[model samples]
Target chain A: MTVAAARVPAASTPSFIGGMSRRAKVIWTRRLVLLGLVVAFEIYARFIGNPRLFSPPSAIVYALFDEILVDPRIRGAIYQAFTEVLVAYVMAIIIGLVVGLSVGWSNFGRRSFYPIVILLYAIPQVILLPLFVLTFGIGPACKIAFGVSHGIFPIIVNVVAGMRNVNALYLRSASSMGASNFDLARHVYFPHMVPSLFAGLRLGMTLTLLGVILAELYVSTGGIGYWTKLYAETFDPAPLFALIAVLAVMAILLNELVRIAERRFTRWRN
Target chain B: MNDQANFTTRSIQVAFLAIMAGVWYGLTKTGAVTPLFLPPMDIVYATFMRLVQTGQFWSAVRVTLFTIAQAWIIAVVAGLLVAYLVTRSRHWTAVMEPLIASTFAIPLTLLFPVFILFFGIGPASKVAYAATYGFFPVALITIAGLNSVDERYLRAAKSMGASSFDTFRHVLFPAAFPVILTGLRVSFFISFASVLGGETLSSAAGVGKAISLAAELMEPARMYAWIVFVIITAVSLNFIVSAIENRRREY
Candidate 1:
């Protein structure tokens, strides 16, 4: 009878309160902290902060749905930015792969050209923003070119690094077995490149986003830059905050896409 | 064989550069590309010489350097403080490190407009933006550096009757110095780039502003001149930094 009573009491305790693993608890704590920050900001903005410069979370959300999304002009600008990023990313991958392969395929190519590539990469690309504008004009073309310039370097550098590190033993054994150069490349070089190339893709996405946005903001006469400039000048912080939040979300989603692709493609490494 | 290979690579690089110069000169001199698109080399050189002699050039450079210095100071102080605090406990590290890293993954440039809203289009805005941008690398690297110190060193120091402060000072700091130095170098360049970017976007003064202004005025020669100056400075700075790092590694 005593054992039955104890079991009943133990079973009566709430499972929800007792079931969390340590990681889940930590994750919940982080979420709660973030929520707490949002709440704090909401309170400060509503009561204490300057309305012209700071808008509460609720107002920003409302503005997002009502003002920014519903407007056709703003929508087109966002679309243009998205398209620019996509095109630039594709171009960067193609060009970076070509350059990287050509320059990293042989000892002569690596030694002769890699230093020059690094030198070009070291320059502050922002310093050339104006030059880009002058060369391509202040259109989507300028933004796309700038994005490619920024994104291509990381990919090339990483591809070269990856291709250089193939095991000498593997190469010698394969060649001794009468493998052709094409066979060697397919069997050895390609496998080694997957992980490093993915890493570069992730970085390339980030830099491409940065380059496109920098061009967008610098041109201030059209696209997202114009809208941001207008909102800032007019001191309409709600729509302004909403627009920026949208861009941030888009960037995060793109980055996540690259990361997922990296994981999916590089599983052989494990 | 290795020496010959080295000589061949060196000559190839030299030849490649010579050919590029030749092509550029040939294209411009022949007017195959318009002067508006690619100014003559002599014109750009003369423009750069004239720009260097101007007081406006010096002031613009001064402003940019000053902004970079300010941003760097802010980033270092805040980054070290946060890193030290967060490293006080493993739980803190677990909670904060991912938060910092994920936030950094989002191009912080998206927030540049917000910065302008609050700080306006002055050096103040650029300072805040650059400092915020730079803080991430400093904090992340410092946290890693501090956490990576060998536990055996700490134990040895403790067994020798060393106090906690002494243990940290003698055993921990030196071991972590190289990584922390790398973090500082990275942060410096980040600050430099961010400040330049901010000025380029919307600023009243700085080298970036000068470049943009030249572009707006359709003064291609002047703009190219400013660009060449910046490229030289940036390249030289990179070399200087690597030299310093090599020296540190030797010791």
Candidate 2:
């Protein structure tokens, strides 16, 4: 902090002022356009685009309460998707943590399984949503399964990575003090792994949402996906837009929760 | 920390692949599971060869890759422009970075139907969605990477009589290049997934469509074959990018 602040002294010399610009002005000038672009887009969307292509913000806004909130089934499906996501996320954490530790903690296990994990992670899991629905049945189970598959890999990878580079010195020193196995794990390994676990959680949250949303859309038999398909097929963008906005709000809140948790848990780390 | 032997790491990786292939073969060959449910390794290999030989696979792949390429190009250009605009200030990166990041967290799969409705079932929809999905990470990373560059380098170049353009060309570009490249790699892979997604949802043709068609047609072996091909392709791209990235850091 001091070093960075020291540079500020030379931040406003005549020569500095000659070419230097105010950071505040630069920040505002760039950010001011965000509102401008939205205003311009609102104008274009509301006035120029095909009504089917986009609703004017006013129409879309009206649809949120009039069409979406008024429909009990749509509301139910939205809630169902939310619950499925929450459950799937918890399941993914448990499975990923166990699997990651099992493989990563042993050289032999790591050699056998990490390859499979990486290979599966690379492939686009969304492509298999239909098959997942077919196999797991076209219900929340399939969506939850798909979501777990997407969510678990990032967690496993991050957890394993966090364990791999535990400076041997810490382990050695702990053991020298006659620390028991559980004590060693608690005092050394757990603290070392905390930051990376939170990092994985952030990624896991994003992927879990993607997985659930993909499965939901693919099922076309039940849940939010069913409603989205209905709206699209019937050429009703109002309800479709409204339902999606609700989902977006859910996603934002979930992501924010994870972010807050990450901050709370990983506060000691750099 | 003990530096593990390179040969040991190499063998571990190789051994991992061997065991995986063994399990895959064992699962299918013993007839414990139905062939359609879990096709034999030889059968899948045969299907792969047939698909590749007949060139039925290329058309779908070409379309999918083309969509990804187009979207990535659009995203890179737009994201770089926006990021450069954002890097003009510190506070802008702070406020707008979160805004962009939060907007990006939305599944975006929700917007797929909207894209399909607007653009019709075509590559255009695929391109738009893929670009929209890829654009966020690119812009976010570019701004972060550029902002994180050391100020002394900029000042040093300025004191040496370099103009802003020269400073950017010589100092800023090189420093930010590695992080920006990583962003491109991330975006490209994401764009690939999203393009596949758009095509699967509604498209004239693409690899995703191939998978969907295969599944509905009940051709499990062929579906497995195509999926295996995509998995290989994705893994290889990741390997190549990581290799290039690792190599770049040395120079």
Candidate 3:
């Protein structure tokens, strides 16, 4: 009997009705909870909530098409915000990479500069928003610059960290085989730092978006900032909600794009 | 040798700051950047000294600090509560952790307008905005901390016939305290910064408002004074927080 019991398999196979995988169950439960919350919110807004201060989900959806898409200025503001974020993100990556390399390259440089970099990072950059506007004017230039300022630090930190751990033996062997400094950096350092760089890129996108939005909102003379101010002052909550939703969706999509690229580049780690 | 290396690095760091100051002085002197955009360093220092002596400056600082305090309290309480609830079961943690993290990927700054609408453009709105911003990091980190408790320790507690409350108090809380403290530190900074951002965007009062107000009036000297003060405060706070964290880590 003991031998027979030892040979028997466990009953862990998936069944049709009551044996759903934990992952699937978690997903379904999350979806249901999200749907329920939305429904509850819709009900509250339509019946009891103040229209001027709060908007129902259905009206928000309708306003996205009827109010936002119909207005050319609103469309342009959205487009400008998007363009600013793109420009800022690219600039941040390039500048961050260069600065990070130069600073993190040598022992003396890293020792002297990394603390300064971190100190600068700790200072809330938002306090300087007004100065940026004063310098660059209330244009896309100011917004892009501000965004780059916010986004670059993460990349610099990550790049330095990535470079810190390069295999000494590999460097020794490469140099013994007559590899130049440039060759060692390009071949050994770059590939090793790719994973960390991607992590920075992902975070950089989020911070860049944050910076751009802060600038857009701060300069209330034009663009999405103007519209948001106008809508809030006029108590047109629907368009305001709709506009925010669109921006949120845009942020999510951009973040997802960066994340996908990160996964693709960092596949070797897994 | 280590002490010598440290001294050299420290000297180099000091030199770097001196160079930056020199650059700023040069930039102002050369008119490469206008004094309107970057005020003269001496002028800014004088303005900062003058501002600190005034009651108005202190009031604005007090207001901003008070708002940050309120926001941080709300964030910490709500965040820990949610984290506790979510981490109670493995299933719940798996389901909610990703959801919470994904929300952070979408920049919460986009929600500032809605906050202004509901709470008005006062310190109230700023508090709400900052609280929401601070909540994410605290909740995420706390959940991670709580979940990281060793399975063997938990099993040992269970086998020793300890109650769940006793197990949590003695076993779980101690193990998780460091991470939770880190989370709180991060939350405090996030709250501080976001409140400043909210005031800068739209507010009637606070240090951020004062800076913006000065800028709007084209008073670069005053604005720079406020900015410099904030930078000093932030750096000092960072050092203080790190020291506290290090002290706690020894135990």
TM-score of each: 0.93, 0.88, 0.94
List candidate 2 segments past 4 Å from native. Answer: A1-41, A106-116, A268-270, B1-12, B160-163
Q: What does candidate 1's lDDT look like per residue over A35-74, in tens digits?
A: 9999999999999999999999999999999999999999
Model 3, CA-based lDDT: 0.87
TM-score of chain A of 2: 0.85
Error of 2 at A204 (Å): 0.4
Better of 2 and 3 by TM-score: 3
Single out the weakest 10-residue window by summed lDDT for candidate 2 chain A: A1-10
lDDT of 2 at B69: 97
All candidates: DockQ? 0.37, 0.41, 0.48
Ranking by DockQ: 3, 2, 1
Q: Which pairs clash in model 3?
A: none
Residue range with the least summed lDDT across 10 consecutive positions in model 1 chain B? B88-97
Number of the top-ranking candidate, with DockQ as the measure: 3
Q: Estimate, for each residue in B206-230, the C-alpha lDDT of model 2 and write its tens digit.
A: 9988988888788888888988888
CAPRI level of candidate 2: acceptable
TM score of chain A per candidate: 0.89, 0.85, 0.90
Worst 10 residues of 3 chain B by lDDT: B242-251
Better by lDDT, candidate 3 or 1: 3
- The 10-residue segment of model 2 chain B with minimum total lDDT is B1-10
What TM-score does structure 2 among the candidates reach? 0.88
lDDT at residue A135 of model 1 (Cα atoms) = 87
